[model samples]
Target: MSITLSHQDKITLHTAAHGAVSLMVAADATGRPHRAATDGSIALGSATGLVGHVLAEKIKDINLDGKSVAELADHVLPALTAAMSLLKQQAPAEAANFRSTVIVAIEAAARTHQAQPRPTVTDMIRKITAALDAA
Candidate 1:
């Protein structure tokens, strides 16, 4: 099925996808947050299908400039769930694409640690996964 999205919906998807990387960057404690963010963002940029088109847009509507993790989560986690809910309603296959896209991005972000991700990073990943599942 073909899915349509309003401008706000596009923004929400962008914010949710990129905001997730931002969250991972924030949670990185190994002092390589930039690398984590870069890797995660690269993963998002490589997304396929409709999710890719939406994510590839140059959107300035995203407002993830939160001062703290809690502040960021206030918008991101819900956006994650909302993105999933919307996609699941309009395009179930794309919903799965979106979920996998996000998970891959977060995993790319976490991989910056070389060994295992730190506890905080792992916890943040868990929260992200939970938010996705909450949809």
Candidate 2:
């Protein structure tokens, strides 16, 4: 099915996707945040379909900047839920696609190191997943 998203909708999707990666990077306590960001971004770039198209754009309206993880989550978590809610309303398939894409990116970020994700990272992932599923 075809999906029509407004400018705000597009921004929300973009922010949610990238913000998820940023959260994962922040969750890293191993000083591999840069690598996590890079890997997560690569996964996002590999996304296909409408989610890919939306993410492939050059962002201008997104403001993922946050002095703390809490501040970032305040913006991104809701965006995740909103994006999912909107997609579910307009295109159920795209909703699932978006969820999968975000999950892959986060997992890619978490796997940046040889060891398993830290407990903090795991908690962050849980929070992100909850936000995604909150829709």
The alpha-carbon RMSD values of the candidates against the true structure, listed in the order shown, are 0.9, 1.0
**Top model number, lDDT:** 1
Candidate 2's C-alpha runs over 4 A off are none
Model 1 clashing residue pairs (backbone): none
lDDT of residue 134 for candidate 1 = 97
Poorest stretch of ten by lDDT in candidate 1: 27-36
* TM-score winner: 1
Instruction: List the lowest-lDDT window of 10 residues for candidate 2.
Output: 111-120
What is candidate 2's CA lDDT for residue 12? 98
Tens-digit per-residue lDDT, 1-135, candidate 1:
568999999998998999999999999745599899999999999999999999999998898988888999999999999999999998999999999999999999999886888899999999999999998
C-alpha lDDT (0 to 100) for residue 2 of candidate 2: 66
Candidate 2 per-residue C-alpha lDDT over 1-135 given as tens digits, one digit per residue, 9 for 90 to 100: 467788999999999999999999888746599999999999999999899998998879998999998999999999999999999999899999999999999999998767677888999999999999999
Each model's backbone clash number: 0, 0
Error of 1 at 71 (Å): 0.3
